[model samples]
Target: MKTDVEKASVAMRELFAATPLQLNEHLSAKYGAQIYLKREDLTPVRSYKIRGAFNFFRKVIASGGSGKTFVCASAGNHAQGFAFVCKHFSVPGVVFMPVTTPQQKIDKTRMFGGEFITIRLIGDIFDQCYAAARDYVEANDGYMVPPFDHADIIEGQATVAAEIAEQLPEGVVPDLVVLPVGGGGLSAGVTGYFRDVLDERAFVFAEPCGAPSLKTSIATGEIVTLPKVDNFVDGAAVARIGDLNFAALKHFAADQVLLLPENAICQTMIEMLNVEGVVLEPAGALSIATLDQLDPQALRDKTVVCVVSGGNFDFERLPDVKERAMRYAGLKKYFILRLPQRPGALRDFLNLLGPDDDIARFEYLKKSARNFGSILIGIETRDRSSFPELLARFEAAGLGFEDITENEILANLII
Candidate 1:
């Protein structure tokens, strides 16, 4: 662990130096808490993943492990970080990514590794890619570099904590530390180091609401696999937490684990982008989103550190991000309305809408009906309260409608 930390610190110097420990005034004022962001997003790979990857390789090479053949399975930041490490160490790495992985991620991974790495798109999901990577590693007798769930990886991730400790004002320990959990390497590493070095600080673990592996593990006293997961917050949506990480995190209170709704996280992402000009992946925003749930009075004047996990967000996803943010903030909604089949029916319904309401989408589900037709309407409003007023108007006018915004089954098929 000591060696890995030392090597990670050294490797970081060779890259673009240290990521900034930036004080974010926008968040500080909003929460009434002194907030600072550990900008892992500014890392060379736009994530802290490189720290762990470099440490893993450095330790292996120092231990006489062959640098010629290394294997890993990741389609996201991990692959890019591993590729960067391979190039830095002059090692040959075979990276397996899911076939459905985005082209942007694939290109970034390749660009980081250059000629030192070979990427293979294996299967549709990460599990399949992981299995394929294991097979290759076993067959070729190559070293398997796990994305997380390894001592070296955890040790390398601890460097973030070390840096934070060093960067803070003298004799100051943050009141709270917020971390986003995927496989939990970063959280485990940071928490482990703090427990050993610092006096006391509350730790809050954030996970995607769709995939609360750490929260579930803490609740059940064992790691449980989620049967299904929403991949919207793809970065931190792990089905299960790492065994080692679970052990370290299991002692925490269940309430300490904050499950952030994927849509709600979008607001934080957009806020950071627009206000701070900071691009954050969904997982990166989890820590910031958790601040909303805290008591403003309790947090006032207290120093808080939130880890901004990664910034590998693809610009192509901007539309979806904006949509989710609006929906979560209640500024946008979708409804299935049974429109009366009358000449003046459309005019009447249109008149009922409030001044703040705008028809974002108006589509006929089926126009063949004579009595009534199902219309899928998406409404955007300047104020969220406008929805209730509009609903009241619809009620007085005897309009039949169903809010399909939160209906998963219907949304899956229609929205």
Candidate 2:
């Protein structure tokens, strides 16, 4: 498998060169470790996904390529990769993407393939989209280019491990390899390669809290389908682990995987953007987000590599990403406040806020009664500590308020 991966890596040179493996000083300083970012985000499609697509196409085209069609379903990155490969091969392909996929990804996929591929918007999630693609393939007698889960796809992804091995400084060894998990292809491929070639293998897998298919399946020794998957980390939010993928990863203990909150992942994304000028999609930020969760002693002075999976973030979502980040860091909050229906009442509430507190949103829900009115208020503060001080003042002033920042139903409806 490692040799196959190496061969694929060599063949891939005909497409794009190796993605950079750079030492991230900002993350290294914060984690107290020698941290490096395996920058899969720098590939032609701004993701490592192109490797798998290209390899799959190369082998398939070599065998036969008369009138067969190719089809694939993806959340975003895979679609772009498949599209790029379709254009490279001049083969007719169709890509199915989640309807909820960011417009940037959908547009890029179309641009990459040009006349070679057709983009189809389907279903609400990858699993549903994949089912639709499978049905299409069956009905049309077309070939399916799986985003992950195939032996060829895994072999292609393993080339990342091959590149990492070649790029690391001579005589340097990584104490830990952090992988972001979606459908488990990258993790399985990379880990399988490491296990085969490296004497000492250490890995930490990160997955969205809302989607823990790998962790759940590993624990049960069987694949388990999730009841619900949060699509916030759309790139990594998979409902079920692939059977082939699970088989490659089953040897590892369940606890080796970390379930990261979506908000925390957003926070990491913002930090990387602001502090390092590195833009990352939610799933791309997963590996880096797990740094603070590790034992400080475990990371101190050790070498770590975080695979930055993709950077195809849509800037239009920046405000929402910042909002989630601020809420996670306690620097911003939303609440419903009850105030007397008087001109002076608004002034009184304003006075209760500390100097650092700024009203981000103010809206009056219909006046509940004659004397009292419900005001939906959102506050942004420079410091997290400001919230406690402001809350204390509100309590002393007898201002009744309900914190709705974490209220999913209410927050989604209004804020």
True-vs-predicted CA distance for residue 61, candidate 2, Å: 2.0
Which number leads on lDDT? Answer: 2
Candidate 2 structure quality by residue, lDDT tens digits, 278-317: 9999999999999978999999999998999999898888
Cα deviation of 275 in candidate 2 (Å)? Answer: 1.4
Q: What's model 2's TM-score?
A: 0.96
Q: For every model shown, what is its TM-score relative to the native structure?
A: 0.97, 0.96
lDDT digits (tens) for residues 1-415 of candidate 1: 5445655776767765777888888988888878989999989899999988888888799899864599999989999999998998888999999999999999999999999999999899889999999999889999999888998899889889878887888898898999999999999999888885544348988898999999998899899999988899888889989988888778888988988988889999998899988899998899999998777897899999999999999999998899889999999999989988889989999999888899998998896477998999999999999999999988898899999998879877877
Off by over 4 Å in 2: 65-67, 98-103, 122-128, 197-201
Question: Per-candidate RMSD vs. true structure?
Answer: 1.6, 1.7
